[model samples]
Target chain A: MSDAKFHLYYWPGLPGRGEFVRLVLEEAGADWVDVGLLPESQGGGARAMMEALGQGAVPAYAPPVLKVGDLEIAQAPNICSYLGERFGLVPPDEAARLHARQFQLTVADVVAEAHDTHHPIAVMKTYEEQKEPAKAHAEVFRTQRIPKYLGYFERVLKANTRGGGRYLIGSDFSYPELGLFQIVEGLLYAFPNAMRRIASQVPGVMALRERIAERPRIAAYKSSKRAQPFNPKGIFRHYAELDEPNAMK
Target chain B: MSDAKFHLYYWPGLPGRGEFVRLVLEEAGADWVDVGLLPESQGGGARAMMEALGQGAVPAYAPPVLKVGDLEIAQAPNICSYLGERFGLVPPDEAARLHARQFQLTVADVVAEAHDTHHPIAVMKTYEEQKEPAKAHAEVFRTQRIPKYLGYFERVLKANTRGGGRYLIGSDFSYPELGLFQIVEGLLYAFPNAMRRIASQVPGVMALRERIAERPRIAAYKSSKRAQPFNPKGIFRHYAELDEPNAMK
Candidate 1:
């Protein structure tokens, strides 16, 4: 693999979307730097992220952008796919690669929906202002969306005739499994009640999440300081009111 | 291109995410069939889509799935990217292809947010059930999300020194431009008031939309019976109450 150092620019807080990117890097054992986590004197932090965003001739729509030499890539799935290709984290076959990307995109969809549970109306507005709607949004998320998405991944795992259904795409532990790991971890953090209730329904997915965590590198990364702990400020916030099961009932 | 005929299976009525796939097929002049629109006797319609979904070893999570030979691909952008690789609708260079996928994924983000405005609380519940929340959600979408996403596209266009800002990725129109075309069309249909107000700020994006419409094949397809009209039942729905500007204010 190329020894080119990769620079990841994301908000210096909770894992958020960057965790997906970080998982891929850490799993692949790639040499990368989290710019936001570094000291300002070292040309990092929120200011560094903002500077990279503005400095790029093509400004990133948002952070969690990956900078590789002169080219800066945005979007979490896109970055993962790029790293997957370079580090052989995806399947060798084209169709399998496409499927891997498709699953990753689906994972992105679930992540966005999960984030919206807390900020249902306006992300710019305080959660306090949107509390009522967030309650409603989180209800559906915990009930319908969680099952639909996790169930889909469950089906994906069961249907894969490769690797005894341990992988999401091909017969291997691709970049997307790392993504699945993040999604499962985020859900557990955000909605422990719902996730606990829903976990049994998606044994394959839960197993895969455990499998990813058990990987030597992943296990090391999780215990390391680099693996940021989940907080309320991130996408999957643990708002007690929003995490209630069957709130409408 | 290969003499393979593509079968696209989506919900029969709504453009929804399928339109992104449809636009690519239309613009590329690919021989494809809309499985949901065909006669049931001929192995088509919603039943056909359901059968296809069930038939896949790994069942599709949702619709707008493309069937080429034996492989059934789901997710709009994934289908487009696959076709793009074969039809030369994407840049020949690897980095550019990755970037096009990036832009397409961002478009997916915008589309998802736009959809969430109308179904902020519950997808399974009726729009009326979530009407109050939808109004609040749409207000933020109109005032903030529309500009933020469109502005991002505008920045992408401006940064592309290759085509003088005519295309999103490369000097030539790519698959993402087709996706962009569909997004602009959907926004204009669903949020005419907000779009009219926001259009001036993202002239680059608007112009690109117009440019895509002006494409010979796309123009022909627009007038063709196959070009489905926008409806309230789709992702970009126009509920009168939901379209009110700054409703919270």
Candidate 2:
């Protein structure tokens, strides 16, 4: 039932944008392939990516674009929502589904802000060139924005009616765990102090991350070459300068 | 049916973020009032804003949040989708509804990018201070991103099987138009030279904008004081330095 014809086109070296999709398919136990991680698959990578983007349609510029047969969707949340539907991970009700997507978009927004913590001024400029602004902005984000988002997500999780599964769908294996864990892990990696102090309050979310990390597929993938080691090149790059010691707390 | 219990809270000045929700409600012909518009209504502005933001929600960071009796929702697209559902602007099917949401989110991505054209470096900095960076980024966005987003949207509209409507929903006013046209209008105001050329090729989208502009609620809103005239302080600021006449196609 999981033999999916999905091709996720992302860069080979970075646990980049596409990792969210990869982690999800792994959790769903779906049959999908990483299009570019293997050298021999790079051409297919470009094809899957460009087609999903559409000819003369608009270059996605960045990777982690996904293809479900003929559709070439680019945005991460867009891909996640599509897969959620095809994989039966979305809520049964329309409003619930909208909320799921809204939550996903919020997560994506958090991730983007995390990226900017490292690259604040110009996406094209080096961290050294933008260090001052990056530091100032990261301070604002970590102290003010981070807690706001985390607290809100915690509230939403508490509102979830799922009794014990600890998933966003609680009892259901959903990508919220993957997204939340990625966020937590990224924050832990990038803004350790702030995330650590505040994270203890969101026990359910933290527990879900630990739980997902123990999932067989994710655990196996984590050990494989398929999982790109987190480095400065990815969305959640660790910059010691930005993550001050007391910033997270 | 249109006159229900919808309260919209946005900045009292510029149409800004509130315009997205305003346009959708108008296009849907929903019964909603622009809260916080008068002197005595000052406090309602504060209350209307706080609640529409899904009280205690992190995303409630800004205006244009919507409040029904009890549910307060924030984020531009979230509010639009909620209204789109009640107004029949969204499709009955979950897939189509999600698709509509995907389209709406894309519009939002572009809107943010458009905003960045003027404030690429720091949100707190004056436009003049960021003028050089803004000019450079705007060049890339105008030549590259504007075409990319417009083309993607045009293709989505063209691919619509429910075709033959002057709107994204095909024959109806979907809120995407309100958002996209806002993008178009902002880009045009901000980058006249680039739009003069790009708008020519995007006839379908242009037509849709024209159609939406003709909707009585929207037309009246645009003519009334409610439609804040585009100014330098809003998301889509018009800066001469940022838009060099020589840079356009």
Candidate 3:
């Protein structure tokens, strides 16, 4: 990459969508700062991040905004794609890069769906208030959406003769691989019962997940304090009621 | 810009996300085919589209897949970005292009939210089946989400001294401008009461909507047979109950 330092602004205390961008930054070994995690006295934390987001010449719609010098870009998948292109985390060819982005966007779709399982009626409302719809939404998500998405990825992996099933595009690990790894991890944590039931059917996806976790930089990052654990407040929350696998069979 | 004809695969009707890609193609004046609109004898319709989706080396997770020769790319925002880059429909500068994409992705977020307002509990289930939760979902969507998203876009427009409040980035109209137009049109159709109530608050967005519609190619495309009208089956559905302005006041 260039000598430019990357500054990432995300909500403090949760991985959420920000983790997708963080994965790329971690894997690329780029010089970066999680601005939201820094001390408030040093112009950090949520307030500083919000100020940066709102005050930029090109204002971002939400957090997980990436600032490389003066340019600010938002949307987690877009930021990851930008970082991937800059850090050589994406393939060299245009077609591969486009496909990688397409895959990453699909991962984003799954992440959004996972978030909706808890907040089915309204984002601002609590899960308890929407538990009825949440249950119904989680049912479809677990039995249908999860399998469909994971199955599609498994097929993509199996079809990637170029990567020999190790990556989403070409012969090397790219941002989409990292995205898949993160989504699989998030899904497992949120829906352990359903995920376990569906695991055998998507061996390729599981294998890729393990391979990504074993990567040296990723391993280090996972163990480091930078890698925040999934929580009930985040997108991928584990509600015992939502995690039932009775419908999977 | 090249002689290569683009083939777009989306569900056969109601505009939906495909219209976002269609707007780019129409504006670019690129030679393209809406494969889903063709007759069965000509290898058209949903079945053929599904076959192409499944058979492609780089399989798309969903439709609105753009095929240029052998390269297949999916995701509406991603496809729009690809077409924008190819047809010079995006800004020339890297930062401008990135910001355009960031804006387009935000538009996509709004579209997804609009879709959920009707089918809150599940996608596979009918709106009738999820009517209770859909009411709650639509309330928040109409009251909070609509204002929040449109307000954000309005701020972006006003901040663009470079575009002079005309375009999202730099000096010329880009894919995101078209996206903003499509979204405003969709939201107005989907939530007329709420949209009408909120219109005066976002004058810039409404004005941009008018300007985009007046553009020669876009104007022609809207009047053409290819431009499908909004219907209940599409993402932006008009449910009379859901579009109530009571919540707005």
Candidate 4:
């Protein structure tokens, strides 16, 4: 393996998309730094993160950017795929690698939808400013999207006879599996009532989630200070009204 | 180059995300077929596309899937990147390839946001049902997001001294440039007033749009019987109220 120290720039307080990149890094036991979490004096914080975004030859439009030596990459799924390939977290075959990236991109789609549940009308507006539309959007999300995505993943898990239904790609656990684990965790945190109600229909997905959480590196990271809790400021925000499962009926 | 015939599956009568892949295929002069547009008696239509999505070992969650021999790839950007690598539409350097994918993913983000401007509350609901929320969302998208994203791309164009500001990647034109062309076309179709109002701020992006359009293959495809007009059905839908330039003021 190439010995390269990696630098990650993302918002510090929230797990957000950065956590997706962090899972791969932690699982690979790779050398990396959460540059955004450091003090401003050491070239960290939001200002420094913003500067880092504009400094790269190929500048990132947003955060969750991965910088290794002179190479800078952005977009969470892209970063995860790059890191996955680098640390042997991706599959060996070309087709499987493409499938892994496809799965990660699908997970990203779900994540974006989840973020929209609380800010349906505008990203810049507060939840209070768009609470009515948020309620309407959250209802569809909780009722339709949640089950659809979970069911699709459950189907994928069951169809993966090559992995004995244990993984998304091959016999070995890969980055997309980590991504699945995170999405499930975030959904549970953001919409507990709805997710729990829908969980029975996706046993394969839930079982995989349990197995991922039990992975040694993942377990250690979750219990560590590095793991940030989901909050209103982040993508998957919890609002009691939005999580109500009565909408499903 | 491999002489594999590509089969594209997407919703017929709408360019949607499938056009991004089409631009690359057309530009490469690759042998491909839009299977969704074929007659149902010959194994085409929504039913066939839906079945195709579930039949592959690596099933796609949604369409705009590219099937080649035994390989079935989904997600527009993933398919474009794969095809780019296969047909020499991507940069030769590894770093440049990653950057092109980054730019493509960014374009996808904007496209998603643009879709939200017309369907903010629920994707299942019609725009008429959520017209008020869509109006609120579109205002922010037009006034804030349009300038932000276009301005960012303008900077990318300006900073790319390597390509002499003609492309987003290395000296050669690549798949991401095609993606940028599609997005600009989409925004103009969806929000003509806002796009025209903001045009003066992003000369490089607008100029790049012109160059991409004049590409012989792309020009031929755009004027051919295959090019589907943007309507209210697709991601970028035109609504007079949403396109009001007064929002920018």
Candidate 5:
């Protein structure tokens, strides 16, 4: 079953956006190839990823594309939803599936905001060139966006009629939950000071994060060498000046 | 046919994110009610929109939620996809549908970036409060992001074996094309200065915009009073200082 594993094309050396996809793949115990991990000569690494992205007829707007058999697609939520359907990780009900996608998309929103805090101008520009604006962006992300988004999820968790708030959608541990886990992990890494304040209010979300971490496979994956560390180069970077909550005023 | 229309929940006065949903509904010729347009007593206006959003069991994280019978979903792209399926505006093939979704999500990404140019620090804060950072954010958006995204879409259009670049997906029209139209419209409104510069290089995207605008249904919708004018309060706002492409150092 694992013989013809799915191929994941992403930039190497940082989890970045690809971490969301990696979480779902690792948790499902699915056989997949992280193209970045393969040898450069074997059509791997950043150059291979960029070449594949550039050549696609449909043209994905960015990386972290999943190629399964003949169908290749980008966008983390779209990929997760597809994988969820394939692996029985989504809600069985029709409406529930859409709700799961909403949650996944919202997670993507938060991730993008987090990324923008360090690169308020553009990703193409160096953070050093944009630190002043980054300072302002980080403050708002820390104070407003984080709580608004995370708190909404907390409410959703509390309101869940199924899974008793442990899962995002129904009673099942769905892929969106893995997304939430990653959001929590990244926020903790990027905005520890702000997340510390938010942590007390979003106990449900924190608990969900802890539970996902303890899952046997997830625990093993996180401890394994394949799991990448949160680095400054990635979406969730921790600049001491930007991470401080009171700097905006 | 227009009697029992789908209900749209969004803030009044500005098209905002709701415009994306509105374009699809209008082009599909689906009868729909803009709840924000109704009187406060009859469950219209901003209060009504907020209350309806609060009451949903599924809990939409933001507005532009669509209520079709008992199924209410938020997230503009999600709503558009749902409407796309209902109105026969989506690609019939599974892979193509996912590809359409990828395009829709990328459009969402560009919209978010555009919005951040005005509200770089926080949406909770006023434009005045964040004006300094916004000027900086907007500069990079003008010089880099606007071209990168529009250029990418131009390539997607050129690569399209379907619709001969007239439609985003296959030979027929899809919801994502409507989304692309809205993006172009909003960009033209918000950053007329920058858009004028990039317009020359993205002829395919520009041509697609013209074709969608000329469609009989869409043309009628634009002339009708139901079509709201672009205002400063929406996702795409025109701040003179922020719109100048050459302002950043």
Candidate 6:
């Protein structure tokens, strides 16, 4: 691994999308500094991060990227992959590694949908302006997409011959599972009734969430002041209209 | 290396998201099958590929994934990395490889926006329904996002001295650049006036796209009818409403 603490640039509050990376680092016992959280509140925070992210050959290619000296990386799942590879958290076998990545991407899809729950029209449009479409979009997501993705994950869990573990790959906690928990927790935060009713059907995923939450690092993170609650400002916004029962069903 | 011929599954009509993987395989002269284009009038062609694509985890993570036997890898840039590592397209040095990936992820971001041109709201919504919102989103992307991404890539080209030619990696076209060109071409197709104006300011990106477009393999592919036209069905739909020159300028 590269020397010095890996620097992470993300909005400090709300745990936000950046929390997925932070959670994993906590779990991995990685030495990483949350750049935006470094008391740069006077001015240079996400603005600096965004500006840095905007630089170079791949502009949309910034933030959520990790760096060690000259090596800069971006993309949420891609960052997870690099870290997972570094931590030995990823499987040694190629097939297993591929499976882990697949799980991560599926989670990202749901997370993106979760983001749409608040900003359904254009991200440029105020969330209040798009609130109606956001609610409608969230209904479809909760009713159709949630079950579809959860069911798929459940199937993968059942199919895992590695046999008997809450984590995706095995009994041990995998970062893939960590991301899944975050996704589910956020969905629940956004659509509590919908998640409760639907997730009750996906026992495998439900259990996976509980198990991941109970991890030592995660438990500490949650118990500690460091972890933030899901909010309207983040991807999984808790809008009462979007969370209405039978909204999607 | 692997016993099976690589199978790529994507929307057959346009060289949209999946084209990146196709370019890599073609450049390497790797034996591969494009499952989507194999006789749509009949059944089982695109369907089978689609089914297979949803198989396993990695590529199963998302489309434009490449399958090699038991391994189905996904995530556009990740797939590029895997193929690059295997095909010797990525740099052998670690720092360079990571940097190239960083650059490629930036390209992937632009490509995503290019897709957003057609369906800015949600993928499930029809173009007609989303046209109003899409206009604003497309306008922002064309004016703000395109130049930012292209300018960054130009910086990367300037930085990669050992990377040789105008190619993102220098000397030869890495698979990612081909995809990058497709993104630029798609943007140009959708927003000619915007691209024409923006491209004039970013000579490196403009020249790079032209150089990449004229490569022997790309030229051959373009002339051979394998290359498809950019259309409304794909990411960058050419709507006269979104391409306003004076407003953008």
Every model: iRMSD: 1.3, 4.8, 0.7, 0.8, 1.3, 3.8
lDDT scores of the candidates, listed in order:
0.86, 0.70, 0.90, 0.89, 0.85, 0.71
Q: Per-residue lDDT tens digits of candidate 2, residues B1-249?
A: 124588788876676777888888877767777776644444455455555455532235456667676555667877887788778876686545655666777778777777767766555667677676567678778777888888867776776646663456544556667787888888878888778888887898888778767778788989987678888778887777666475443
DockQ of each: 0.73, 0.25, 0.85, 0.80, 0.69, 0.34
Judging by TM-score, tell me the better candidate of 2 and 3.
3
Query: Candidate 4: lDDT of A11?
Result: 92
DockQ of 1: 0.73
DockQ of 6: 0.34
The alpha-carbon RMSD values of the candidates against the true structure, listed in the order shown, are: 3.2, 4.6, 2.6, 2.7, 3.1, 3.8
| CAPRI-style quality class for the chain A–B interface of candidate 1 | medium
Model 3, span B64-101: residue lDDT tens? 88889889899999999998988898867899889988
The prediction achieving the highest DockQ against the true structure is: 3
* Superposition error at A4 for model 1 (Å): 6.3
Better of 1 and 6 by TM-score: 1
Q: Which residue pairs show collisions in model 5? A: none
Q: Residues B73-167, candidate 5, lDDT per residue (tens digit)?
A: 88888888878877888867888889888999999998999898888877787888888778878888988889999999998888877668766
lDDT by residue (A1-249, candidate 1, tens digit) is 124499999999899999999999998899899999989888879888877875675567888888888788888988998898789998788777778888888889888989888888888988898888888889889888999899988888888887687888767788889998899999999998888889999999999998899999999999999999999889988988888655335
Rank all candidate structures by their DockQ, best first, as comma-separated numbers: 3, 4, 1, 5, 6, 2
DockQ of 3: 0.85
What TM-scores result for chain A when each predicted structure is judged separately against the true chain A?
A: 0.95, 0.86, 0.96, 0.96, 0.95, 0.90
TM-score of each: 0.95, 0.80, 0.97, 0.96, 0.95, 0.87
Per-residue lDDT of A1-249 in model 2, one digit per residue for the tens?
123587777766677667778887776777787776534544444455445454422234356666665455566776776677667776666545655666777787788778867665456667787676677668777777778777777666666556352556544666656777778777887887777777777777778778878889889988887787778888887887777687434
Q: TM-score of candidate 5 restricted to chain B? A: 0.94
CAPRI-style docking class of model 3 based on DockQ: high
Off by over 4 Å in 6: A1-4, A41-60, A164-167, A170-172, A246-249, B1-4, B40-44, B54-62, B159-173, B245-249
lDDT per residue for candidate 3 within A1-249, as digits (tens), equals 124499898998988999999999999999898988889987789998899888888898889988888788999999999889988988789998899889989999999999999999889989899898899899999999999999999999878888888778888888888999999999999999999899999999999999999999999999999889999889999999998845546
Q: After the best TM-score superposition of candidate 4, give how far the Cα of residue B20 lies from its true spot, in angstroms.
A: 0.6
Candidate 1 lDDT tens digits, B67-110 = 88878888888888888778998878877787888888888888
